[model samples]
Target: MRALLEAAGVPMAVARSGLWRPIHPAHVLGIERALRQWGQSMAALGAVAAVRYPERAAVIDENGTTSYGELDRRVERIAAGLHADHKIVAGSKVAILCRNHRGFLEATLAASRVGAEVLFVNTEFAPPQLAAVLERHAPDLLVHDAEFAVPAGIPAVPSDLAALVASDASAAPKPESPGHITILTSGTTGTPKGAPRVPTAMGLAGLMASALGRCGLRSGDPMVIAPPLFHGLGLLTSMMAFFLGSPLVLARKFDAEAVLDQVEEHRVGVIVAVPVMLRRLLEVGPRDLPSLRVVLSGASALGASLASEFIERFGPVLCDAYGSSEVGIATIASSADLIAAPGTVGRPCLGSSVRILDDDGRPVPVGETGRIFVSSGLVFGGYSDGSSKAVVDRRMSTGDMGHLDQAGRLFIDGREDDMIVSGGENVYPVEVEECLARHPAVAEAAVVGVPDEDFGQRLVGYVVLRSPATPDELIAHVRGELARYKTPREIVVVDEFPRNATGKVLRTKFGS
Candidate 1:
């Protein structure tokens, strides 16, 4: 453990902060009972929070606030209700398809308490995609919000916040084994795959230490989570809040202005969101949000222009985290690093090993691009379909192409599959996209390869413009900054780009 901590670059003082603080005898007893009931899983994190900060607010959602003590009791009753009425016993797979709110947490905790594996369904899934996921997972029970339409033949229960908390049953079900959490990958390239994982004590501790040291976040600080909880960034932040006894403020939907309002209302110190959310928040223009100390951006690339603009307008609160669903968090770049390194994704987090590997799985030299592989305790073992990512020397491939600088900062070039071979020259769309984004008129851009009789493959750029800019002008701008072959063959200016729930541009949806 000491070596792992040191490898992660975590200071010894931060490592000591992972130790348990003194608590009252009564709280200790409650924690012990929770430990015996839920084992060392995420459920136990919630249990410890409830005992340590019973009077503090655990969650603040659209419905109102829930104290930690109240949340604990509600989870117990919901667990009992699921067991008594739904027959959700140990090993049962409970698929939850709700937005961010108290009910989502309630259903998750309740399901885990009974040793049932929890699958967090993406709320933005299309009907066919949702149906296919349901068919594939074959969950025993589905707990969902009233707003969504559930597929026929699944035993589903309503997840209304009021109704769930008003249940009469107060007894918690004891799980036979620790429940596992399954987070689905964002299907930007293809069908989303499930990454199932069981949390270990050492893994959780390392994650906590790295997050604390990188983000400068302390336990018990109020936090606002703006991304979907089903995603890796949101889920990890929520788990950290529970473990640290921090109050989590959630919203059913993400509205940029409303997020600012909530931060001011709750005096939140940390704001967790994806890069698109940060862009939207900045679009709302500058305002007084003094309580916000850290802005954690993840789930997608944070382009250099966007990061600089955000930090300039909102102070040095922006922190970019680079990772994926398969591997938890690998690197975190602070505001200074964002400005100094520009497009760099910062250094590896504590207890994480990141390497750029060539085709033969050999390490690439610094400043050379290759497949990004990471070895971390928080990485998932495999997908639910019994398939796993390629592992070399205990390191798992992140499916991203990147390189490290002489300063040890990591910079993502693009997705390995997104590389385009045009006119016998290799081009990464991210480089072109970044060049286009630096233009004053461009708001967002996506580049994809299309079939061409002459070149075999050609680059086509789709852009959403904030102001007026001709296609020819944008193409010329890219040509000026990058190689002629790397420049888009054609540029199309559009009002908007097709994006997923988390605001990732759907390159597959780009029209020919």
Candidate 2:
């Protein structure tokens, strides 16, 4: 508890400037009034942080820096505009469809302030997908970037948020409740569903405690969030930044060299990214990054070769977070954990539990693969459609197959549905994918099963190479690493794999 509080700058100086001073009486009163009106939403966090660190930079985006005081005022003004102009009152649903920038934060915080349920729409969604999601969710207002077109029947305002914040409007007062924040599932296997979770103080603290302690994040450290704010990993880390009074550096797109530039420019202490972003950073080759202390990876699998290579090049600053949209962050792997056991997702977080259960819900033996179940306090009640995951003894299934090491570290084998039976052998594509990734010529690999006449299924490997290599030579590399049946029957070279917004490969695009 103490560590978590300290990391949040409870008694420490504000981030970047390290300014420590007593909270003025007026500031304290303002904070209390704001919280009384807005409750525990992001608006409250911004207001309270403003009272404590009024002059500190709360956000640094393309529009430039916004102090805590300015951020609080902007959020409140935007909320007032939505309330008065758009008639978005308590219980109204507001869908946000912007990339990582000040607009995304402004819209989200504003909607929450007015007690409106905020649905974060993925920016990478195709036009049809976006239209379908908006239609199904039926949000009252659609807050989107300028690049996106507003669907019919939904009231919307583009990313020119500055105008809205400055527009003539009545001040919005307190509401009956703090509205829920809904994050749509990644929808890798199916259509995305709304997963709404009302933020609770205890749930937020538990996640922060585990991440801060395991990843070496601390007070007054600047952070750059490279992933989209819609993902759980990005959302949670952004929340961590607000509470810690850290200056959040954001960009609408993830560019490897540009991210490194921001780290050096802002003296960033932590970077939150997905594994594919990490791979791009490695490809760019970091130089003179003295202020970069932690690189947090999540939202996708971090292959063993990638983890080891990142750690080797970056000198043990990589931490892998594990969880999903259904269940919030359940585990955090520290640098040491990654060093000792590459690809391990660390251990269960504080106030969280992990269980390896068989089909009938019996506990599996240590080091044995089985279904992965996690119980994080932040798990949503149910999807927006009223469908929920199967919960066995309070732990919800993560839909993954994994094993735990003797040291209690968890390693994901693959998605339970992704397992393939080839020649009467159960094979995990991730194992072969990892082996292929280790080859000097291979940059990354994705393996999928195809129906075969002889074997039940056959493995087909698609690889993006760092250097030129023939299929025969790559097949030999995998043969040297694993059994013959485990190797992919055919290797296909690709320029790049189609990726979802959060950087996971869209295997369905590969004709799987």
Candidate 3:
């Protein structure tokens, strides 16, 4: 399949052509060796950070902060406890079910120390859903976060079982061991896939380094993480802070007031938020948060008008980035680009290649709508079923539809899965929804492709109006802004649309 994909004729999107500098052969080998060496155990990476910056705070949980030295000690002790108490060792996958607490970090590090991969189960996953994930992954050890205690034989991380591992004095695993992370993808469509987290983490750090350069992140940057620790964005952000020897202040869940308080209290320099969160923050945040140097918004299409509003309110420090779980970091719109382009997801980041491809997997013209494909520096180690071809594909149609402008900036059309084909025309719901939300009366809107006999699939707009906007008025208003064919066929004015815990619209549950 990969060979077939490689043999296909594809022209590079003008935006992607000549955008990246090839890594030196020697440097590539050196980095590969380093990644391999660190793969034996994630603890080696933690050890390097601990030794390099022992006094630096590693994590700032609700209780207090733990320095890198303390974090290392905890990992060593907990890892020993894991092995001695639970008899878990190399090749064991440990399921960690916890909220944004310190135990998550310590348990992950402990599992890594013993060459065990950590399976991060979303705390929000209901009992059956959680059970399904556990059964699928088949973790040898289960670390619940104290609150959830129903699953028999699943030991809590800080329980007596873990205390036993802490009692042991065994050394951490050597480098060159088997891969040590099995993270479940967000799984918006089907079941979540277990993706290797190591490659994802490395790729994210590399991308962050390339885009922000050395000046952005520092030793004590209190990363204000608002996204739940379960999601890829949250988990990877926390891991990057840990890997870089910086302190993370997790919000457990996003709350505008709480986030603002933390930013001021911790003097947080950086924050990673989605586009929606940024809007919410700006709506409720204090007039000034002087310590915040960078505010990163990603995981969804960023709107130009929204970006301008944010900059006008919060000052020019917003960085718009684009990437996914399968392929790590792809493109970044720097602070300058956020001001200049406003809504662009930015040019492809260093060590990555991107192209806009049409339905036939051929690159579209400079300013044409097509599926976005990314060849990234850090691709997943393939799916859990052990298929590396997709991970190594020179170009992967990201299943996202978008177009590139003549200036090489990418504008998202919408997810191919979410695109509504109405009367033989592709109608991107995001574009229409964004247009609807801009109205004076509408506060929030979600556009979904619904089953329709005539059009194959019709666009349905679910809106949360701040004031009052009838369905007819909204439908007419959208028609004026968008192409008549692209306008939503139906507008449903409701208090709210069903959203996941992360606030992403759950279009699948429209009828139900």
Candidate 3 lDDT over residue span 407-468, tens digit each: 78777767767655453234566767787888899998888876553344568888888997
| Model 3 TM-score, all chains together | 0.72
Off by over 4 Å in 2: 1-31, 186-189, 418-512
lDDT of 1 by residue, 219-255 (tens): 6778899888887888888988887778899998889
Q: How many backbone clashes does every candidate have?
A: 2, 1, 7
- lDDT against the true structure, each candidate: 0.81, 0.81, 0.67
Q: How accurate is candidate 2 locally (lDDT)?
A: 0.81
Query: What lDDT would candidate 3 get against the real structure?
Result: 0.67
lDDT of model 1 at position 362: 98
Q: Write one digit per residue (lDDT tens) for candidate 2, span 20-92.
A: 3455799769877877887777667766777777788988999899987788788878988999888999999
Task: Please list the residue runs of candidate 3 whose C-alpha ends up more than 4 Å from where it truly belongs after superposition.
Answer: 1-41, 152-166, 172-178, 186-189, 200-205, 386-393, 419-512
TM-score of 2: 0.79
Error of 1 at 157 (Å): 1.1
Better of 1 and 3 by TM-score: 1
